[model samples]
Target: MPRTTLAPTLALMLALASPAAATQEYILPTLFDVAGVAADDVLNIRADPNPTAPVIGTLAPDATRIEVVEERRGWVRVNTGEGSGWVNSRFLTYRTDVWNEGALPQGWQCFGTEPFWAFIPQGDSVVLGGPDTPNDMRKVQSVLSTGVFRDPTRAVVAEGMTLVSTPQLCSDGMSDRLFGLRAELVIQGNQPRMLSGCCSIQP
Candidate 1:
């Protein structure tokens, strides 16, 4: 028998032409990012849980409420309001709803380099206060999803705004190795803002 080989591109095409290739064969991730959403680029929803699947729709760069109903490999099924379809799971970020209410600090005095920040929570609302604060302070409400790029933890959102807070801390007490919470603010039609500080849960 003579040895022979085909180009990678042609090989892929032939594989797709095969009936088996059409079958769903990809693995799925255990967790789904239903609440998470795309931050910048549009998120493509496909007919199948695979990138090669036909693109049925696209989500806005700051789109939200995206739900993942299925998963295959790293791809997730999503409902784009238009219809239900699949999209790459990595495209979605942690939904703001992931924030654990119990984990939130009733109030926090965060220590940063120079100007400090304080977080005071009242009812469903929160206040960000600081000497350098542009205004007396900024008031925000806790909403379901935040547009954070990769934060899969707690988040707060308003009409055109979203706020994110880092978890309590990985280390106990103050240590150079222990990095504390740094609140992030995301608002539509504006640049992302950060309130970098290490905080202790209000006592």
Candidate 2:
């Protein structure tokens, strides 16, 4: 067979073997926030095409300002100011809408394990609670599930007096598991509340 024909034949074979062959590639926007660590330590970003491989230094975190990079196999390759490195994709947040300056929604809070949450009025509120530990400054660390919201008609918000947005570091944090969530509740309201967190809800 001609060399050119051979290439096409091989391509077809590979496609047939791949389960995602029929799926269209959709590039989604992502957001990367500084996870509790000082911006200086967040430096030394590296890449990990292979999760099992040691992280390879890509750049200094301070030098790079671009948010959201392409991800592969549950990992995201971030470009530090100096180079590129791979971080677990679960640590980053992906959003379809980018927040515009001075255009944020009212009463909505952006909450996450990455030390940031924005509050917008009339927006979905997320409440995340997990195991309480004495050493944890935030006193809570966990994610929310998509099914958490029960009633769309009622405004969702976070409740409890101690619910302030702060960074909490955990070695086992993963984004896909609802590392952070938004809920609707009154900050000053007095009511018993059960919030979802890192672990599954018991029946």
Candidate 3:
């Protein structure tokens, strides 16, 4: 992490003025894993993106080499060997860590400074609002899926997205509750933005 506060010195001023003073987060894409579910909790490869879509097949156990077909309305169309169907894109990540628990943390309720943006992770989707957003509809969370989060310090690529804090502490105006956060976010393929303020994750 870059120094949060710079020292008061002539050399420090020059150092702060340089472009290196601001760092862009890097995306380290990896094979995303979708496991750690009970038999009944297996991901349902649906015919479409909506929950009402018919279930074509469940995700095959130990399935690898999966291909991303497309993404729409926060759902990703994948060609899993068992079948081709739409799954909640947010549920799918790009990391290979195994978490055989029920449901994992949703994503984040993160904010930035200059062009302030807020990401609220609600279950399988996110609610995004920021300076560039023009209206409520535009605030919909549909960030491209780059991969899941891994690595100890969260230095991994979320060129997709990630879970940062305990879900319980992730509501708005609760920066006081956020804990153990490494200030970084891979918002998209190329837009690796820095976390400017408080951030949290939801389960």
Writing each residue's lDDT as its tens digit, candidate 3 over 92-132 gives 66543322123322343456555666655454455556778
Per-residue lDDT, model 3, residue 70, is 48
**Model 1 global lDDT (CA atoms, 0 to 1):** 0.49
Off by over 4 Å in 1: 1-105, 108-111, 134-139, 143-152, 158-161, 168-182, 187-192
Clashes of 3: 7
TM-score, structure 3 vs. true: 0.30
Best by TM-score: 1
| lDDT tens per residue, model 2, 36-72 | 3455564334445665666555333433223443466
* lDDT digits (tens) for residues 88-179 of candidate 1: 77766644332233334233333454445555555555555567774223445444433332232455554455566554342222342232
Global lDDT of each candidate: 0.49, 0.36, 0.45
**Candidate whose lDDT is highest:** 1
Q: Write the number of the candidate with greater lDDT, choosing between 2 and 3.
A: 3
CA lDDT, candidate 2, residue 25: 33
- TM for candidate 2 is 0.26
Please list the Cα RMSD from the true structure of every candidate, rounded to 1 decimal place.
18.0, 16.2, 19.0
